[model samples]
Target: MKKILRLTRHALLREQDAELRRIFGSDLEIIQVSETVPDVARVLAIIEEHRPDVVEVILPHSLTAALTRAGLVIPIIRAITRRVLHEDGTKDAPFSHYERIISLEIVSERL
Candidate 1:
């Protein structure tokens, strides 16, 4: 099983987390850390404890670039979203990340 650490707490992320957990079943393991603190040490400790294969860093205020450049052996995924307004003025295309991330979430939910 692939281990994944999720770093996000936004409404969308939380929704995705729940949905993912519902979809993945058992192929993956998800560990989530808080977004309140940007402390690298604390985050690193959580990552160390989980020992995840990937750390999904979602919308980190100022630490995204730094963490990405830290050169950690574990793969770090940065989640980005695009807010698009429809012709009728409705928001669309809310949460946007790599398809793999979506797949991972779906897989985890199933498990």
Candidate 2:
């Protein structure tokens, strides 16, 4: 049996949320989180509760800083808005629509 990766997303709007669902499909168990910015405590609490394999946050600079300061070990992914495909239909791009802020292995090392 394949391992089910649990991913928690924070502050994603309707379109981004739909994109995530479309991209990840059933492979990931996606959890939606609406918390943002100064509410690091609430985000931390959600992390503790869900214990997700990965946490995806939109515009995460502040939250990332707080998580780092607090020494939380979960991996974080930063979701950014960008066209999924170019006008030429080429997939090569400087950055994906979303990017992982930290890798799971890196998080494990920190832990």
Candidate 3:
């Protein structure tokens, strides 16, 4: 059994919850938090409480900045869809702190 902190918009949470339930059954304990930038503190608090093995951030803008600043204590797995493409065509550097980075394509293919 493992815990996962899900940082996503409340609107998206429902779908995510359903999907997670289907995939993990009862093996995952998810703590869903706000996806807005201003709610970073609350999300951080949830992270501290759960101390999940992985923090799954949905929205790149809000979560990435907050996660970077919070000094996330656990591994992170971001569900990125569009690659972070730079102006010169090289992909932007993926956040390095996470043990893994899960792309939306991968999730879709698997699920």
Candidate 4:
């Protein structure tokens, strides 16, 4: 069986589960985790323990740098979500646009 380690809590990646299953096989062991501000030791520990063939993660710059320094090359796949809202305070207007929220960056990344 193929083993996968999911390091984020977001459901966006679940949209590809069927395709992933088809590619990997019928049966898979998926381990899911959502960690905020994981230290280098903790990161390596989880990887060593799970020993997954695939790991889906979104880590902060510090953690990423630490991993890079620890001689690991990680591939990244980020889920980008867009919400369109009208300038007049409704989403139904013709001038619908996306507004950036500084607060959601951390929450989104963690998820």
Indicate which candidate wins on TM-score. 1
The CA lDDT of each predicted structure is 0.62, 0.55, 0.60, 0.58
Q: Number of clashes in every candidate structure?
A: 15, 0, 0, 1
lDDT of 1 by residue, 4-98 (tens): 78877744365555555454444778777655654667677767788888787764444555565456787776555688988998887556543
Q: Write the per-residue lDDT of candidate 3 for residues 1-111, one digit (tens) a residue.
A: 777777776343345555555645668777777646456676677777778877877654545555666666566665433458888889864332332442223122444
- The TM-score obtained by model 4 is 0.56
Best by lDDT: 1
Sum up the clashes in candidate 3: 0
Order the candidates by lDDT, highest first — what do you get? 1, 3, 4, 2
- Against the hidden true structure, what lDDT does model 4 obtain? 0.58
Over 1-111, each residue of candidate 2 has an lDDT whose tens digit, in order, gives 112122333344566555556655645566665544356787777778877766665534555666656665655666564456778887642334656555222232443
| Superior candidate under lDDT, 1 versus 4 | 1
* Full ranking by TM-score: 1, 4, 2, 3
Question: What are the root-mean-square deviations of the candidates from the true structure over C-alphas?
Answer: 10.7, 8.8, 12.0, 9.3
Clashing pairs in 2: none
